[model samples]
Target: MTSNTAMIPSFTPSMNPSTKGTDHGVEDGVTGEKLLFFNYHEYSVKNYRLIGENTEDFHEQALIITHFPNFHVPRDSNTFEGTRIVRISRYFKGVGVFVPQFSPYLPGTEPAAIFGDDDTNAKFIVQGEYMGQFFGTSSYSPLSEYLTEKEFREIVEEINVQLRDAYNSWSLINLLLFVLDLLSFWIMSDLIHSLSKRKLDALFNFIDTRNKSLEKRGIKIISPRDSGFLSVCIVSTVKT
Candidate 1:
């Protein structure tokens, strides 16, 4: 009979995406001063605090993953220790709500140009380049010290697979929506144009009548006091 227990692996590979000519795992032309985006999924939280409330430590723990800096680790909030595995759960929840609609709008089939090599774990808008001194450290930080390199890589691989699937699915859905919208606009254009002329004429008439009423009431249209009398005049016009 075969043993039911499984053996633990000793080593894993790096999950970082390969860049051209550089082993640093970051895209070309990415300077240090750029703004890094991170996605934080919080598990437990306390009461909501309005403005001027003492609410510094609302969440007990959170799982944060670097998003914008892409494969590069950011100096600020670099550590991910003591956080539970909740990425899979979040992914499922997002899929149920059809999160693919938010994928970047681009023409043609080549999403890789925009998404780069690893599209899954690091999809974000590259918000301009950093022109000044770097505010954050450029050194890479391990997700956890406890896990071996292989283990870490494997986990990240799983995450990337999940993310890629969601994004690809979303892109397809978005394409369908775009086609539908185009067809809809084409079908309704003439009907909309015909109705708009009558609507515009009615609007001009309403504005003229309202202006006359305001003039009769001796209410300067821009005055603060005119707001109260404007409502009264509107009601009288409707009654008439």
Candidate 2:
């Protein structure tokens, strides 16, 4: 069954949220297996640039699947609005296949297409949900300092492999996609990490206040609306 896991997170008008009209129409893709063993949460937020030559919509998306990124999650999730439903599968698992897993999504922007060749061995259908602005118009942290240049290059190459195979557009377009993903990842790694840190901090603060040692605490705020980014998650017991 389709689930909406986000309470309406307030849309900040000061941020001046705006929606990018769907270059394509909305679609409903169904008829596939679904594995939701681990509780997965995700958030999709849209960003807009007001300083560019012309104010334009900037989209981004983030996700955190449970278990491992190797497990297959059938295409059963629906797109909410501006978010494009995209799935990546390296190992294709079928319907009748049993897996114990879950994946959580994060806030991000959506691109025209993804280079997801390794995304195979399974089938999925993405349906559009929301179509307007997905996030507050203004707000973002500067790119964080993570992974050395060597590590960053490695990731860029890995992501490019998928894009080159999926979209049969052109070399120039492929190059452009790679550049965007690189910059986007730099920003997103920071975004997701900060949220995680905040959650952990809050949990610890709560424990100290209560004078109770923590046995376990798992809590994260993940937005599941706004189409600029994807929030689909899959849970499984394999490593990618």
Candidate 3:
């Protein structure tokens, strides 16, 4: 059997009209309403341990059994679309064994029956109803007992601070990379435009020199738009 306890409080406020000739709720010659506030109430829960009888007669060389909840691994399109079920079991030889009493039993004898111990002595199982369907275990070594509320809060605050600092650093790095990408694009575009314009200017200069040589030999070339056909006319030179 397992039990869970949680405490929460609700706040409610009521307003009342102010009395005449009382300056307690008066502002700018107008009487303001008074509020009745109720404070929050707190409660605590007592912790208890369960002790049960051991009915199974097992040998002394039996391994200690610990049961954890079933877990599910999410599958994606890369793998499978369904969830995968998994269960885990941990075996301990000497450590994590809870012996209720010290008994001088033989190696083949049942420790639970010989020492009259309960089921808690040889097994540790967490109920799935209380701790959800999937629960994983983590170790905070050197600390045996559960942490206090203040200690847990402090650890959470420290983790949040570290995460914020990391986010800011990543933001700065992304900003720098974005700026460098823009600068590279602009420089490449300007270089290509300059090279294209230089080649265009060189081609125009060659065409202009050829036109001048033809004119010196008394040949006048007319454009297709002016002569209706691309044609060259021989000009008569009047030499005085």
Best by TM-score: 3
Please write out the lDDT profile of model 1 over residues 1-240, one tens digit for every residue: 011111111111112122112121222133322121111211112223322434433432211121122111234532212111211112221233332111111110111111222334232222111221011111111222223345434433433343344345346654565466588976644444423234334433544554565445322112111232111111111000
**Candidate 2 per-residue lDDT over residues 127-228, each given as its tens digit:** 111222221111110000112234323432333233223323345644565566578976654444433234345533533442232112211112211211
Clashes of each: 2, 41, 0
- Report how far residue 35 has shifted in candidate 1, in Å: 15
Backbone-clash count (model 3): 0
Return the clash pairs for model 1, or none.
12-150, 100-170
Quote each prediction's TM-score.
0.19, 0.17, 0.20
* Higher-ranked by lDDT: 2 or 3: 2
Tell me the tens digit of each residue's lDDT in model 3 across 147-184: 23344234323322332333342466545644665889
Q: In candidate 3, where is summed lDDT lowest over 10 consecutive residues?
A: 1-10
CA lDDT, every model vs. true structure: 0.25, 0.25, 0.23
Model with the higher TM-score, candidate 1 or 3: 3
Each model's Cα RMSD: 24.7, 22.9, 38.1
